[model samples]
Target: MKLQVNIQILQLSFLALLFFTPLLHKTISSAPFAAVLHLLSANLRLSLSCTICTFISIFYYFYTRPSQVYMLNYTCYKPPPHRKCSYQVAENFVSRNAQFTEKTLDFMRNIYLKSGLGDETYGPAFIFEEDGVPTLNYAMQEAEEGIFSSIDALLLKTLIDPQSIDIVIVTSGSFSPTPSLSSLILNHYILKPDVKTYNLSGMGCSSGVISMDFAAEILRSSRKIQNVLVVVTESITLNWYSGDNRPMLVTNCIFRVGCAAALITNDPSHRRVAKMELVDSLRTHDGADDGAYRAAFQEEDEKGINGISLTKDLIRVAGMSLRKHIKILAPRVLPLSQIVHYAYSVVSAKFWGDESKPIVPDFKTAFEHICIHTGGRAVIENVARVLKLDDEVIEPARMTLNRFGNTSSSLVFYELAYFEAKKRAKMGDRMWMLAFGTGFKVGSLVWKWLQNSSQEFDNPWNDCIQNYPLKT
Candidate 1:
């Protein structure tokens, strides 16, 4: 119906142009003006006719195109052999440390044990090596190893040649080294020279979702089918804190090394083998305010030691940012009934002079599954409270946190892998991925499962799927 309207508009516009050009030509009697008008009208009519035919052709070409964007496949990095940081080993590493005061050591231990982290989470740089001194060389090596392995697995699983990727996006919140992460992928894969590449830094943990939105928008606007490879990872090797600042101390306790790679494409041929279809995405930022901006800040401490400081206001900021994000997102995804109820509540509260706050819409009605960022226990709990979610709904986030720790930008993909491993996602089910980043930014992506996913060999949970949902 819409296409027909556009076609009709083109036809009408062409007829008007053709009719006016000749009528104007006839009205001009002077030789000079008449010839000029005649030439102008002839060119105008010809151009209009060409444009009309072009529009018709282009519309017909697209009208027959497939209607889905596919996430062909994705893989989360499983840290190489012997890189795992179990609780006992982490405690021992702390015990052996001469830098932290006993009081600070105890605090770190408390956060580590209770941070929803498990024994399998991996650390970067010298933290995992036999010797515990970090070096720039070692940090780069660790980053490269993680990126290569993850991307290799993703391409292998998808059976896509590296040369086939047309776009590359790499995001790491804290660490972006020389020959940028995207450049590293280009050099490693030897992709085509014309491949467009983007390196996004300082976008925080929500960058994974941001990258997805970035790729989707680009693919949607492009005339030709294209594949975008998005690599989401964080650099823990160089960001490690040796400082005693309490806020900075918490980062050391919770964050671990992780990376994830995904292949997203607008190519209709790949939809048959894709896991999910990108449905919708939204992002909201609250960093304009000082408090929200400083909630999770990175800077050098008094001694000039660099690290991210997780201020006490972070959880509060997260809650506020999420509230703002959902406000815009609800209208896009929520059903009409729920939307009407929310509207009535708002109207009643404002006009009726009711003191009660407006009702929170039931997001459960919008999506079958939700992948909330595993920022920490507090962040997860706060999101659950705001959304009024049940324990089952938050299980993936909790389990992902426990198993992988805070993987920075790549966290949500790990949670999605968990859902696939558990076989919780089925064809036609809608999944909402919500992630919070250090810029105090909130991002959301909605996806519809294209097919039922079974356990894949590269699944990080393959070894211990049976042991999940650990009692808190």
Candidate 2:
């Protein structure tokens, strides 16, 4: 329908232009404009007015159309072998630490065993140090390593010059240094002097998708903003919980160090080489609900040591928020048949008010690949339940959590890497990224693949991709 309308408008525009151009010639509209008007019939003047309106309308329609945003390429930071923290190494570290009590040790051990994190999850410098200090230097070092490594590999893969980046956005859940990660990039790379930079913090795991949404809008905001460089990383060295608070200790058991860098562009010339095109993005904030806001909050314990308290109500809050989120999102992306069925089911349930089974729109019908945030085992299962997803649909997310643990904002990107490593994503596949963060924030990004993906040089799962889909 839309294509037919555009074709008709274009034909009308061409005819209008052909007819209107001759009226402006000196022969018709020179100093003898009144004489020319006297020579013209009323029908001719009316035709001229109608033709001019058609031309102006067509011009405005094309002028206001939005530019398409594409992800040219992206790379995830692959930590060195020495950084891999085995289950044994983690157990020994916590057991030997003097700050932990017997109770705390047991709690952490239990959580670690059940957290779905594999032995190879990466850790920052602080964990391997003899003295085990979460110093500002070590935190900064971790951030620099992941950020620089990701950007270096991304630039190499995209074959795009650093100077071509028009905007840079850096996001971390809890770490924000004085110079800021964006400025750090500016100092390291000789980028364009007028490049715009933005640093965002405290948004937790959903930051990557949110930042991508922001970058897409930036690309659409102006034609001069051709490309955006987005770097998402987490400096977990300092955020590692030292206190014995059981809820806080979950961080120590599951969180890991990682980063991802992506180059997004609105330049039409790069579309052929781009990996995916942005289809739609959605974000929801549940901060108004106190239970949601404090579900995962950072606070100092009785001992005055800072740590993020992963409250017991977190899973519940997330599930409730997801239901509300999909209610709004389903209509935009679900197939027409699914939409109709879902609408009827919803109306039937409300009208009957019985204890019938709850209905959920089959998101699998809309997305061919899903990068569900690897927040934790429970978080993944909750999302699976809410979306009515099968285990196969969430394999990447499960494998990512086992391999990389919770890398905060970059978790979904790691899942994306997993899809590439598995060689499952093909050109034209519809991809979905769903992420949840502190403040009970939920974000979803829908994408259409521009080309098939192959193993990347910086793919974190390169050596171990074959070992995935481990026994459930």
Candidate 3:
């Protein structure tokens, strides 16, 4: 409506200019010199006032415009050696469990063998102890270790003080304890009394990217320069399922302990030290559709034990969600050449028969590096197949999954760590981070690397990175 009003006003102004210009010319030519001079002086004064007002408005708009968000640094927590779960250790725990029947044990074992996880992935304290239980205390302990360690390292790396943080955002896929994770961070760090906080739960694996997007929005809209500490982690101790439901057993084989923390700031002074600048971000939710909503759901099995089921329709739901998401995102990030090619393909396909499929846009053309979510072997392969990504392009994701397992929302950060370990990303490089969650939601973060990638002391892959890009 505002645009329409502006157009109508422009039209009226044009018509008035046409109607009055000839009369004004005639008046100047025929009227007395003094009268014409007075009229011209009045017109000049009006025009000058309008020009001054326009300049003032433009100045105000620029002064009050939103600030650009930047990522100062990030760290991914590495569990202690004692907490590492080898294949033998995992098998022993499952075999010794009374809850698992021989059939269920066999099913879980098969899933583990194909889970694309390495022998050194870490589990929660409960899984490492002989008689340890998946109690609430252990869950909190797991959260504390992952969250605090990553945040500590991130603060140290960025040289950011706790009291200076203005916003705190924490996200956990399936864990939400009473003193919410955000509150826990506040108390643990003794952050500023007025620090804003948000605890996000039930957002699934994509929550990391979602939280980053959330932080970017906050920084952009804030009145004053602010710093946001985004903590992305998952407490898998309590979520460890003992039920025998086949559909729900995948989590047991894939999920593991992981956490990541990043410090994002809108302070222009830190731009020189920032790793990446928030370029463009997009999020799409297809949960309104029944299949997408039920793709991965938590429910009780026949025996009344609760577990989250990974339905057979999950792969399809992910593909569908990606299709819908990129429709909106492709235009924003893709170069004009690529967008035009894609548009032509799409428009041409509609004119042709249904047999002629619309050509998929080459996302590689837009992003120099992509951090695909390492949800599982199948999920990674599926994303690669859909995007036609090269093996080298997805090596970071594949390696991170092998090393860390599915750390839920934190997986993408681990992949970013992998990129740094290999020194693959350079200054001015465009990076894309993509992840899918339980709500069948897909989230994307487009980042421009402000500095060349450098492996930090806390990089999760620093020790084992040399052996990465392993055999499939």
Candidate 4:
């Protein structure tokens, strides 16, 4: 009996050991899972803490954030004097009298005649008379003073607080030192010494767009930037070359005293009165060639004759530069709809084996308005032909050139203002601005109108439009 009892106990012990052996092995093998459970518990505590911290951060952001000032509205300041000038009859003065070579004069006359200049449909307007005379420094100074007064008047009329302007950008092509135009404006406007200021000199007709691009960059970087004031003008009085060079003589006839000030704000809240919002800008330079630079440079030859000569190749250079500009910009501002149309044209041209076939992208579908630089009549006509724009679409540019006579960098703005005065621009209208300069540079800016723009009764084109004798 003692042996049997011992045997039973031993059997039971063996069975108990057998049952616990598997559980022990599982626990040992899954030590990582046990550790994971501990880690999960710790992470849960951390997650709860993080949630509380996030809630507190959000609360702080809402309660203590700084008040933001959004641009509520903006307008181009047109002082009464400028308004009067716009309405007044422009004087026909021949400041110089160097006779153009008969051949050159005839060539110019033919170009002028071929241009829509004689079309009565555009009506009688101001035409600058070229005299073979040199422009003087005093004349430029006088022009500058007039511009300063005009800017002051416009600023006052616009009712923008002088103190609120954070930056000032001034551009001119003439010798702009010894009293930089920017200093003159700061003093006139009583801007604070701390205000950010920049004076751009030597950039010819393209300076206006260049200045705009620079301002946009500054605005994008600093949230504190509220208002940017851009002043564009040319001093034809100073750079008048008295030489017999036909190119220099051309300036004697074409350029006039003109100044324009534009106020731009990045604050989205001020979209109402703002005529247009800048969309895209492009600049291209072909500085690799000396010929491109010489195409528009001033030369001081013997006989004290100093003036810039126009090269016959300038038009070709401008065309090349513009082609380069379009290549880079077409991808950005061209709407997907326009892009699709262009793509279809490309594919069609490729399959048809007609590489010479031109694919004129439908710009009308993309832009409601176009403002090509008013460099000259021929330049305008060339661009119009390339773009396949109607004469009426280019009317504003032509009229601006007829009246203002290529006011340099500010020409585009003048054209834009003309459109506004005509009441032609409706809300949601898109405008494209193209300009070329001495750097053999071509640049463009795209804008969309925010509201209805109407022509002012006192606009320069008012009388001309009424008498415009042309029909489509």
Candidate 5:
């Protein structure tokens, strides 16, 4: 009986082993495939998360980046439809007649006559009719009327609805506060009451770029803002000083009645005329220096003549100030190619101790054209040397100075018009505008042309192109 029971147990054990062996083999065979499937699932989840994060990062960058607006079109105020009349200057005007002594006349002749005002032999010429009253007040009135009319003509031609403009920037050197020129422009144009407006006064020749800088900042901040209208004019009539001082007499020779109105739009959607896309701007003030302030200042020495003494140091101060500004600004607008070349030159100069050969920055790589302030011949010459620029690069400035004298704040625009009229600017060309003002300030504005600008009917360059390559 015991032997039979043991035999039954052994038989049951054998049957169990046979049934479980195949199951163990199958489990071992599938383990590697299961491990691979689990690893793939984890990797897929990580990849999806990374993709979503990358999309969010890209979207954030786009939303926060500042959008650059190309200047769609711009129009300058045309003088008038009337034919050009012969304008003359009276030698003996009201305030100046009593003050014109032999010494004063000699000084005036030296300053105005020799400095290139038509011919002294032809006598002093003013821009008014002979019968017209020669008072500063009268001149101001005429200038105001002419500017308003020109602006009206421009507005009519542009056909831009007054209500659509987002901002109006007005700049003038002579008058401020009482009857602000900006208010006069806004009221005459019948713009909206709440429309944003800025009146920049006391800035002198640099005001135009200052106004442009302000307008650019506004556009940079707000997406809703589009159109910006800038008016730049100099009221020489109001500030005429009849003093016997040489500085006071300097103004009589150079300044003339001139006004320019430009319409700049931030709307990229509109594409009709040449575009000036703003790239970079810089401003430097050396007001703390007494020499700079005295270089261009108004001094009254008990004589009623309010003379603005333009010291010989003015050009030097301007050059120094410009160098300072460029040091701060070059890294911003200059391309990496230029920066690399400039750096190599500097390192070579330093390590090699090559004091004889100075490294000058190659501005040609940065700008195709340059418009230096048309202040005077000396100023233009000095700037050209400092930047190592050629005469062709500064021709617009020289020509504008010769034709229009010093239009102050609007000088750069006139230079730009000259470039356009000559068809010197090509698509994708870059321009640099440099200006100096009363606060002993130097400012720069950089722009890139969006398209070629053909000669427009109203362009000032049209009339002067024939005479140009002028005797300057």
Candidate 6:
């Protein structure tokens, strides 16, 4: 706000000086007659008035500069006790309890084995018994526990009073309780009664980045709204599929339990300790196209069992969406030399009819670290290929997938945890996080590290960072 005021003052001062320049010149160049003396005095008075006004404006702006937005810190939820479902255990449980026939079970087993998931991945709700009743109780428990635990920890770590949080935004793609997730948070935390709240549902995996984008805009818009608590999670309990639909079964193999809580504030004082500063963000949706819209859709099976369908066309649609998104983002982050080279490649290919593909700009030049969504092994592979990322550049996403098995909306946070656990992020380093979702949406968040972050004890990967960059 103060920055805007300063610019306006500078503009007005320049215009005033221009208008007075001619009068001052006339006073100096003209003969010192009676009329000339009066005119000179008048010009002097106007000049003094303009100078005083400009000084006052400058002083006011300096004294009243508004706070800058900062991402104070964030915490990703680790699976609760007894929730860590190993691959073999998950497979055995599925074999014994799933409603699908033997052939369909074999298909799911094959997908799981080759899904790039490690033994440590987690699931909040699994029905090990044959006649288990599907319940929202477990889903609610996961949401409540995931949200409260992580948020409580973040507030404690940051020493931020819950009552001071001005806004609460919760994004849970699969489950939204009746009181609303935001309301539940407010009630549980006993936050200020007038705290602004919002709940976003059905936004899919990209919703984590989307929620951050939303918070950034909100902080940019209002100085009074200092702090926002954003919770990104997915409910896996109710989403479990019992049907044999191949598309639906794909979700069962990948989606898992996870949640992340972040405190974003416009309080400039927190900048010193903040993990990263949001540099820029971009979002693109290809849902307008039929193929993209249906790439990942929720539908009932032949027997009317509801489940999310991960269609074969998902990867192609993701590539296309990301292509469009990065076209807009590249100019903002890429170095001028890389941008120029990329532009030259495009022009040469267009005019010279060069059959070779136009160059993909070196994103490594823009970001020191990258976190691609761990939607699945295929999603990570496609993003890496599309961006021409190296093996090391793509390790966080791959390893996060191996360890967490696509925690849906919270997956990127887990990948980010990997970077922190490995101590790879340095001060001033730029990081890029990209995610794809069922809206066939793609979201990118660029962050500049504020400090050289050390590994936090609560980081999900704390116990296993040394074993990562696994030989796949």
53 in model 6: Cα distance from truth in Å? Answer: 9.9
**Candidate with more favorable, higher lDDT: 2 or 3:** 2
lDDT of 3: 0.88
Candidate with best lDDT: 2
The models' CA-based lDDT, in order, is 0.87, 0.89, 0.88, 0.64, 0.68, 0.86
- Summarize candidate 3's per-residue lDDT along 352-414 as a digit string, tens digits: 654577778899999999999899988999899888898988888888889999999999998
After best superposition, candidate 4 residue 99: deviation in angstroms? 8.6
TM-score of each: 0.87, 0.90, 0.90, 0.73, 0.82, 0.90
Count clashes in each candidate, considering only residues at least 3 apart in sequence or on different chains.
0, 0, 0, 13, 4, 0
The stretch of ten residues in a row with the least summed lDDT in candidate 2 is 24-33
Which runs in model 6 stand beyond 4 Å of their true positions?
A: 1-14, 19-67, 128-131
Please state the error at residue 99 of candidate 5 in Å: 1.5
Task: Name the runs in model 4 displaced over 4 angstroms.
Answer: 1-137, 302-304, 344-352, 456-465, 468-472
**Better-scoring candidate (TM-score), 5 or 6:** 6
lDDT of 5 by residue, 24-126 (tens): 4455457878665445554554455455545554554445445465564444433432312212343444324665678777666556544433321111123
Candidate 3 deviant stretches above 4 angstroms: 1-54, 57-60
Q: Predict model 2's lDDT versus the native.
A: 0.89
**What's the CA error at residue 380 for candidate 1, in Å?**
0.4
Report how far off residue 446 is in candidate 4 (Å): 1.0
lDDT of 3 at 343: 83
Model 5 Cα RMSD, Å?
16.1
Worst 10 residues of 5 by lDDT: 116-125
| Candidate 2 residue pairs in backbone clash | none
Expressed as tens digits, the lDDT of each residue in 90-180 for candidate 2 is 8877777899999889888899899999998999988888888789999999999999999999998888888888899999998999988
- Give the per-residue Cα lDDT of candidate 5 at 50: 52
